[model samples]
Target: MEDKELKDKLLLSKLKAEDKLKDRILHQINAEQALIPKKRKSKRASKENYFSIFGIMYAVILSLGVYFYSQTEKNPLESNTFVFSVIFVAGSFSIYWFLMVYMNYKKVKQ
Candidate 1:
């Protein structure tokens, strides 16, 4: 190949590289905008999902209560630990379910 032609090709490649570098630098300068999370426009459906979760939680708790009750009957003097555990387990489930419903109502009113 001719020396002049080789020099022109090298110059073209250098220009392309410089253009790419400029774009990357500009992108980095405005990168903070993209880094910020986009706000959620609406979350009505998010309420329904929480309710479904609460429903499942209650169902599971009820099943657990039935199991524990039967077991305690089989052996009336199991352990203090078992009785305390059953009480707390049911209470936590109720609290969480109520919280989800309250949150759901508050969000829906918005």
Candidate 2:
């Protein structure tokens, strides 16, 4: 009976030591993680940035179209086709811009 009791006590002590070792390992891992700096996630350009850039481009293209139209009017030798194509492209861009704005608005509303 005494031998059995001694064996049980030895087993309990070993289990307690193992538990302590596990706890120390976990604590060390947590401390190392805390000391390490987390990397920042990169973000793509936002809708506002896209809008601002495209808005500037749209304005420039429209202005150029108007300038060319005026020039074509003054110089009858120049064809109006180039001005018409510019206007068409500008109109397409404006449509796409408005659609994107509407989709963003809807997403925000949700």
Candidate 3:
């Protein structure tokens, strides 16, 4: 019948209009995303860089402690105390560094 044919044409037109709207919305979204800028390095990466720098400084201090301990030929008691203090400080720094690294790893994993 003509009535049924007219209904089918109307339905087809409605579907086509919806498809065009969807495509336009998608294109706008893509254009907006393209205009946005992305960061090159993350916060985690900057923290890792800071850790590395501190690690190098720790190594230097430990090496200096060793050098001083070896150079001190006289005053055995003074040398022993100095070495003990250096070792204690180095140990504490090492433990703290390991804990920070573990915490960062856990955060990243989650």
Best by lDDT: 3
lDDT of candidates 1 onward, in order: 0.65, 0.64, 0.67
Flag clash pairs in model 2: none
Top candidate by TM-score: 3
lDDT of model 2, residue 32: 78
> What TM-score does candidate 1 get on C-alpha atoms?
0.35
Model 3 lDDT tens row, 1-110 = 69999999888777435678988999999987754432222355647756885787577666766767578855444676666766776777677776776766675455
Worst 10 residues of 2 by lDDT: 37-46
How far residue 19's Cα lies from its native spot in candidate 3, in Å, is 11
State the lDDT of candidate 1 residue by residue for 1-110, as single tens digits.
99999998898777345678988988997795654432232244555666676677667656766676787755423656556765776677667767776776676565
User: Against the hidden reference, what TM-scores do the models get?
Assistant: 0.35, 0.36, 0.38
* True-structure lDDT of candidate 2: 0.64
List the candidate 2 regions with Cα displacement exceeding 4 Å.
1-77
